[model samples]
Target: MQTLSTDVAIIGAGTAGLAAYRAAREHTDKVLLIEGGPHGTTCARVGCMPSKLLIAAAEHAHHASHNGVFGVDYAAPKIDGKKVMQRVQKERDRFVGFVLKSVDSFPAQHKISGYATFVNQQQLQVEQADGTQLTINAHRIVIATGSSPFVPEFLKSAGDRLLINDDLFELTDLPQSVAVFGPGVIGLELGQALSRLGVKVVMFGASGSLGPLQDEKIRDYAHAQFNQEFYLDSAAKVEHISHQGNSVQVRYQHRDKGLISESFDYLLAATGRRANLTQLRIENADLTLDDLGVPVHDRYTGQCGQSPIFIAGDVSNAIPLLHEAADEGKIAGDNAGRSLKNAADVRAGLRRTPIGVVFTEPQIATVGLSLPQLKQRGEHCYAIGEVSFEDQGRSRVMHKNIGLLRVYGEQGTGLLLGAEMFGPAAEHIAHQLAWVIQMRMTVPQILDLPFYHPVIEEGVRTALRDLNHQLHIGPEMVEKCLDCGPGA
Candidate 1:
């Protein structure tokens, strides 16, 4: 066994791990990055980049096929599944190659290609591929082991027929038909993409809401839009699933649709994700495991137990978006480095404005606190402002007017709290709202900002204006310039 020592040891080389490593490197040169799996981060290799590539191809086909509404005539768009997957893989490889290039820059000894297990609080035992062993002792450690797609045992029985986001993009060709087992972000995005790509997609979910939106209005709108695209049993309770030769069968009970039995060419499980901690041997550390079998850590600082270990990224199981993962990694890495000096002022707080999006057409996006979250926190006196894109000028012109945007604000104060939207340019709108919520800006303040006319953003302005009216703050208070004359 070889022995090594480092100032900081970072487990996992995915998004969160890479961010932690970079942040830790700023304070110490003696940092070791350990990867027990592939070098490419999840976003580059599978999660975001590759999935968006598939969505882009699907969007092209969808737009061409549905151009009649725009008075644009074209031949029926036929997609080649093999070529589509090839393009996605080619671009995905490029992204993965970029991450690998960064990994190659570190000293060969600084990176370990092995499975890491905790021997104790400060010591780790790593087993290499060729059966060699290495022991690493570090003053501080950051665990960013990421996560894995949680497929049900019944679904996994189908073997090669089971497709998770991890393997969805790796396919040589798209399956002729698919039964999507969940209608969360992964399920909805992939299911819609596949449907647009000319695959028969049937989606099943326990709730009518799409993703994690807490607003019933937006959820119902999303359900309607998505239901129009494919066969979705939103109120489904899946009882059994099994493999049938090359295909898979699903048995479910639907609220209004009654018992339904269906089979498809493949089964894609978007049930959810579980933290990758089976081999972490966290019991050797002083950290306390949560109900989900993940180490309990401070959300703001990522400190685990009373030790110098921190947990971040998908492993923390807070917010699973790539951007949030990076934020968590930075916090963990920064705190891990500062722990050497016992610095009390070195820790940073986690992001308060939560921004999440599903990249389906007429994208679904939410920012900051949702209606349910606010209600759960005992906030009940908020005002709601909403706009339907169905009548919005820009959406009407673009023929993309099939969703709604709702903003929540303090009833009397007009302070913007959160927003949920299902509309065109929802990604941009959600991002802007996130910034507004982060800055604690009110609806009137947001309205004071410039909004170009006849654009998707006008929808936001309309919502804010409606909120301003409901708040009934005097014009002088809302318009800060009201007290000023022409040349005050």
Candidate 2:
């Protein structure tokens, strides 16, 4: 048995926990990061960083298969799934190794490979894999336990039939057909990845609008590109599964369309995710859970309203994006390091809204408030913008004219409140809008800023000009309407 103490103890070395470890070092001398799983599941490890590499590789194959429009026609290249999986592991290993080595700079007092059990407030019993027990005490704690994939109850006790994001790369061979549940980011990203790799994917989800967090235009545009059959009002209830020689048969009943049995090599349960907080012992930590058993905390600093205890990452009921988790964690780290919570409303300087990116081909990127959501909330907002991919010189050069650039604003101010771009470099535009929306920069202010021309960035300027027109109205609003009207 061993004992350790730190100024702040963080559990889970995922994105939030890792970022928090770095941020805590700014205010405190000692920060401890704990992980139950090995260091292979974080963003730098098996999450976005690695999964995206596989997705991109698969996309290259897709582009090769459909080279006719791009003027480079070619037959479908042989896809070596085993080789692709090998590269996936190889790349994930290299990147994750570098990240793990960087941890030495923070001097983690104990990076235990064990599940932490809270014996009491600020005290924990760490159970190592080798059956060794260690005691740890801390002045403050941040529960960054992250999230686990939510598998439906019926998928339980079934082996190899149902899979999650982590299990995809482990596949030995590609499935002939795949049935995907939920149109969330992970599911869509993975579904598209496999679909691009020539998997016949059928998506079943209750949401009429896919990627509900994104702009309506982007969502509609992507739905057009997916080329998959949508069981749109269908909530699948998996009744049973049977193995017939070599094929796996799935018996499911769609709520809207009655009973149906389908045979696929595999089924994926990507319905969503819930916090991995059960082993953390919430009662022992004296924490409260919402209906989902996720720790209830203030959206800002992630403080639970309990003294010296805060939460971060998916467990904190945040939006569960890596960047969102990292941002909230900086707040939690500051809260944990402080003796009296001296932080100035930790989310004060934080961006007022979130940015989301769906990593599908002709990818979707959106930041700030969506128009429908704004209308639902009855916000005094109106969006004026033009889709400008038609005029981009670079987009023309690439022959990748498949998406839109739309920006939204306050009713008449032309203040750029939100933006969504979904074409080449759409993710780059999303990153830019995150800052634009955060600072509440108006179109004029953004336009005045230096922007190089003959670039896709010009799309922003064009949208801004149209927004500016809507703002000023050219001092001829009634005159213009009157000329257009029958009375005129």
Candidate 3:
């Protein structure tokens, strides 16, 4: 057995782990980064970059086939599934290579290839692949183990035909038919993409929820828009799943059509992911655990009950987005590195305004506190401003007029709280709203900002204008206000 001591030891050499390493090294030279699996961010390897590559391909194919509405006629474009997957794989590997290069630049002594388990709050036992065991005693520890897809036991009936988002990216060719379970971000994006690329996709969800939208109005609107492209049952009643040779057979209750049986080339499980915590043997760490088995830590400081332990990234189970993970890692690493010198150093870090985006045609986006979050404070505490893209100038001109935008404001202060949007250029619009919310801007303040004429952003102004009226602080919205011009 080998024993080592370090100022800070970070588990999992992914996004948060890498960030933690850099942050901790700024305060102390004795820092170690440990990894059990390959060193690449979830975003680069499986989550964000690869998925976006696939989506990009799907978008091009869809636009090529649907340009007839623009007074331009084109024959249906042939989708070469092999070429699509090849490009996706090639680009995905390139992104992973960049991450690997970064990791390679780190000091060799600071990197350890092993699986770590907690021996105590400040001690870890690492088992290397070459049958070597090492005990690590650190002044502080950060858990950034990340997460994995959670497949229900029932889905195991499909045997080798079952697939997850991780497996989907490894495919060399798109399947002919796919039955996607879970209408969350992964499912909706992949399902829609495959359908657009000439694959028959049927998405099923247990909860009647779409990607990240808490507002029912926006959720329903986005749901309808997606259904127009592919068959999606957000609230599906699935009976059974079984393996049938090279295919998977599914029995489910179809809405308005009663019971139905179907077979697919693969059963794609887009079910939620669980934090990778169990293998660490956290029971020995004497940490307070939540119902989901995650440590109960301070979100601002990333400290676990005033101990030398810190948690970050997807393992924190707070915000699973990549940006949030990076922020949390920096906060946890900075605090962990400085905690031994001064307790005051373990202060709150910068937690940015929340923002989420789903890259589907007529994208989905949420900024700041959602409508449900505001309602939790009290229904009357906030007012809503809404705009339908059905008649928005730019959206109509581009034939992308198919979504809704709802902006929220505090009743008395008229402060912009959050927004949920499903529309053309929603991803860009969400960023603007997030920045405004972070700056604590008010509805009128946002309205005062310059908006370029005849743009999708004008729709945002429309919502803000409506919100201003609802707050009784501005003139009532005029029907086809001449100042706003036609389709404004």
Best by lDDT: 3
**Top candidate (TM-score):** 3
TM-score list, all predictions: 0.94, 0.85, 0.99
Error of 3 at 161 (Å): 0.6
Task: Give candidate 1's whole-model lDDT.
Answer: 0.84
Clashes in candidate 2: how many? 0
lDDT of 2 by residue, 1-488 (tens): 79988778888887778777777777777777888787744576647877797797777877665576667787876888778778887887888888767765555454667888777768988888898998888878888888888887765434567778778766666777777777777777877787777777767665555764456666666666565323433334567766554455766676556677777767777788888878877778777668887767787767776556778877776687877888877878776776434633344326356788878766777778776766775555575575657546666666666677777777766667777766777777788877877887877788678766456766666667677667663332232132222211
Computed on alpha carbons, the lDDT of every model, listed in order, comes to 0.84, 0.71, 0.92
- Residue 360 CA displacement from its true place in model 1, Å: 0.4
Runs in model 3 deviating more than 4 A are none
Candidate 1 residue-wise lDDT, 53-168, digit = tens = 99999988886755668687778887899999999999999999999999898888778888899988899999988889999999998999999888777678766678888878
Q: List the residue pairs that clash in candidate 2.
A: none
- Lowest summed-lDDT stretch of 10 residues in model 2? 479-488
- Cα distance off (Å), candidate 1, residue 420: 0.5
> Model 2 TM-score?
0.85
Q: Is candidate 2 or candidate 3 better by TM-score?
A: 3
**TM-score ranking from best candidate downward:** 3, 1, 2
